[model samples]
Target: MKLGVVGKGGAGKTTVAALLAEAYVAEGRRVVAIDTDSNPNLGISMGLSLEETEAVPVLPRSMLVGVQGDVTADELIGEYGTDTPVGATLLSAIKVTEAGAGCTCGGHATVRSLLSDALADRADVTLIDMEAGLEHLSRSGGTLAHADVLLVVMEPSRKGVLTAARTLPLAEELGIPFTVGLGNKAKRPDDRRFFEDLCAEHGVPLAGVVPHDDDVVAAGRTGRCLTASSAPAVRAEIDAVIAHLDALTG
Candidate 1:
């Protein structure tokens, strides 16, 4: 299963990705979680210590360029991927190491290549926590083209809904097989309704909603990983999302 999680910053896409990876790992599936964000922190969400998260190797642009057809995606992952405490192999596509470095077009290409060449025969569940916003959709359609599903995370706010409104069409243009809207951090009755209305208006399928949980906040404050085991309500929500995914692609 190849899944790509995308949303604007603060919408909890990384959280969703990390939880899914951890969930699948606990099920004994070989999982690969790639932090394709410029600000790579999926490692922290996946239960890595601060030192370990910082130590994750940023896949260099030069390596992506050089290893093109010569290396299989699994080989590259085996050579460069870091093992997370949650039992998933983690990789980062790019990082901003210096100021005035310009846009990460090269890094987007790197992710594009990796996803394009991802191994299909393996039983591994590949999850990508993509860069924030819709630029990734516009800039690198090929990056997520091969994905079996795209989870567009949205919150209660207008920007979140707007991002989802813009993103779904792009995923369609890219030919991703299944695209669904995931409502995250929903607090009030209206908050959930807002996402429901937006998805309805946009003609996109609504996957599920994750309520605003204090445990999620506490976990971040304590530098702890926020897994389903840590938050019961969150576990229920994510399990529904998983079931929705299975129904879509089973």
Candidate 2:
């Protein structure tokens, strides 16, 4: 499965991507997790220490500039991918490290090429933590174009829902086969219902809900990997969400 997880900032898309990658790893699947965010942090979320995450090499902008899309799966991954503690290979797409780093158009092109290449078939599961918001979908040769499924995560807020609402049609425009809306961080009685109704009203297919959990917050504070044992309830919801995705895509 080639899955892309996207959302507005703070909508828990990174958390969702990390959880899904780890969950698939636990199921004995070969997984590759790609972080396409300019502010990349999926490495740390996947259990790499801060130093390790920083040290993981990102796809160089120079190599990607005017890329001919000729690289093979093994070549690209073997050269740049790093192994995470959770048994998944992690690849960082782009990071603005210097003052005059040019625009990330090349980085987006590289990710788009990677997703469409044989890399899609090389892993049992390939998950991309796409750049936040609708810009990615709007760009030509965007990263998620070839994704088998796109998870549009939304928080319990109007802006979050609006982002998801705007993203669903763009996913279709990109010819992504499946796109679903996920509600995250629902704390109040109406929070879950709020997203549910808004998604329904906006024609966004509902996936599943992950409620607000202190364990997630605590794990972030301690700089630790959130495991199924650490946050069983959230993991349970994520597992169900994965199952829902499976049923839809399969």
Candidate 3:
């Protein structure tokens, strides 16, 4: 199964994706987690450092205007990306980590194509940590076209709820097939109801609610997967979310 996680910035979308990937990995599944977000912190959340090679090469500016559409994926892969810069001065600016080195323009599309190609033959579960919005996927010729599920993460706030509503139409236009809303940072039963009502009013499915956990915040600061340090409550919530996703895609 291929799952795409998305939401507005600061909505805990990356956290959700990280935990979901961890869940899959722990199940003895060979999982490929692709970080297509410009922030590129999925690796960090997964307890891995950023690396230069993982950085997807940025396509040239001209290619952004559709001139490169005719080019085969292989051709684009062979011709577009560049190696990490060398030397102390360049290295300082290009600081490489296990997650990825810094990239320039059109890097998201390059990464999306690479991921699509890498997963073409494999039947392993693929989880995409998409950009905060669906724009990146939309631009890359519906990169999530094959995704069995699109998970939108939202916090318990009026703005966050509104953002989920706003994203629903975009997901529909892209033919995302299955889209569900996950309410993160819930602190109380009331918070859960708020999000559930928001989803119902917006016509989006409520996958599950994850309560606020200090461990989740601390894990992020220490660059660790929350699932690794999370309390049983947190783990249970995440498990419920994943189960819902699995059922949806089943």
Rank list by lDDT: 2, 1, 3
Query: Which predicted model would earn the best lDDT?
Result: 2
- Cα distance off (Å), candidate 3, residue 185: 0.5
- Alpha-carbon RMSD to native, per candidate: 2.2, 2.2, 7.4
Residue ranges of candidate 3 with Cα displaced over 4 Å: 50-106, 111-120, 137-140
For all candidates in order, the CA lDDT equals 0.81, 0.85, 0.64
Candidate 3's displacement at residue 93, Å, is 19
- Model 3 gets an lDDT of 0.64
| Model 1 C-alpha lDDT per residue in residues 1-250, reported as the tens digit of each score | 8899998888888888988888888778888888888888889999998888888887766345224455667677767789888889898888887999987777777766666645554437889999887777777456787788999888778787778778778888998889898999988978878888878887768899989899888877787898766788888888889889989999
Give the least accurate 10-residue stretch of model 2, judged by summed lDDT. 61-70
Total clashing residue pairs per candidate? 0, 0, 8
lDDT of 2 by residue, 149-230 (tens): 9998899988888887888788888999998999999899898789878888888888998988998988778877888788
RMSD of 2: 2.2
| Pick by TM-score: 1 or 3, better one | 1
Q: In model 2, which residue pairs have backbone atoms overlapping below 3 Å? A: none
Which of 1 and 2 is the better model by TM-score? Answer: 2
| Candidate 3 per-residue lDDT over residues 1-250, each given as its tens digit | 7778888889998778777767776666656565666556665566554554245443442232123454553454345422221100000101133465444334554444444444444425667777776565556456566566788889898788777777777777777778888999998779999998878888878899988988988887776546544567777888888788778877
